[model samples]
Structures are given as structure tokens and as C-alpha cells.
Target: MHNQIDQAAGLRKLKKNKPVRVIAITSGKGGVGKTNLSVNLGIAMAQKGQRVALLDADMGLANVDILLGLYPKFNLSHVLTGEKKFG
Candidate 1:
């Protein structure tokens, strides 16, 4: 169909293995849905076959691990305290 051709023509292939893109979700105050939104957004992107990394840089709460139900065996704190090394 002509519609299918038009839709296919509109698509341009992206360059593979380029530098990683980062999406930072930040807010001034606390107790909003920033963590929830960022977590879901990252999941959605990964589900669509796009590589995704969500860094929880919130210095105060540091609850992204909790939202993801992940209890990391080692965190940056461990690295900073010479308890673990980045490999």
C-alpha cells in the first residue's frame, strides 16, 4: 500500500555503537514521583530494544535501588571506602 511505503520511507536508520546517551531526571524538592517516572521510562526504553542506563544520583534519598527491588551487594559507598574496586 502507498501508506506503508510512505511510513517506511519516513524511517532513517541510526548509526550503531555510537556513544551512550544519558537522560537525567532531577528535581529541587523531595517526595515527588521523579524516581518512579525515571525508573518506568528506563524500563520502557529497554523494552523497546534501546540500551538504557539509569543512574540514581540523588544524594539525599538514594532509593532507586529500592524502587527497582534491587539490593546491590556493593555500591559507590563501598568503592569510596576501599571495600570494593571498579572492574
Candidate 2:
């Protein structure tokens, strides 16, 4: 189990160090399809076998995970509340 964790960490490090371009989509207003674009972009990257982590930092209005229909066991709120570390 420890070996598997180490291997996964190594792979993540390799992916981060790889020469892959990153794109950030932003909008000044809500309901502007920004979330949709980000979701599709992330999906495309992952489909291409690239490592991706989509963070929704909208505070009270975050919806990236919701748009993707993913129910995370823990979110930024948990970390902000000191329930988790920035591992």
C-alpha cells in the first residue's frame, strides 16, 4: 500500500513537471458558461491521459464539482475549517 502511494505520488510529480500547457477560464459575471468551458477543458485534458485538478474557489458560489456531478467527501470548506491539511 505504501509502495502504491509512493508510485502515485511519483506519477503526480512527473505529470506536474511535464511540459503541458495550462489554461484558466474566467468570467466577470455568473452564468457565462465559464464553468462549462473549464469542465470540458479538464475532461479533454484527462481524456488525453493528462493529470488535472479542477479547483472551484468561488467561495459561497462554487459549482465546478456540482457541474461535474461529483460529490466530494471533503472540500475547500473542510480545509478552511482545519479539518484537513493541504496535502
Clashing pairs in 2: none
- Tens digits of per-residue lDDT for model 2, 1-87: 553323234336656777545577877887889888889989998999988878786788788888888887888777666566443
Q: What is the lDDT of residue 23 in candidate 1?
A: 75
- What lDDT does candidate 1 reach at residue 83? 62
Write down the RMSD of candidate 2 (Cα, Å).
Answer: 7.1
Candidate 2, superposed: residue stretches over 4 Å from native: 1-22
Candidate 1 lDDT over residue span 1-87, tens digit each = 653323212112222436456577878887778999999999999999997767676656688899899997766565555565443
TM-score of each: 0.65, 0.65
What's the CA RMSD for each of the models?
Answer: 14.7, 7.1
Off by over 4 Å in 1: 1-17, 79-87
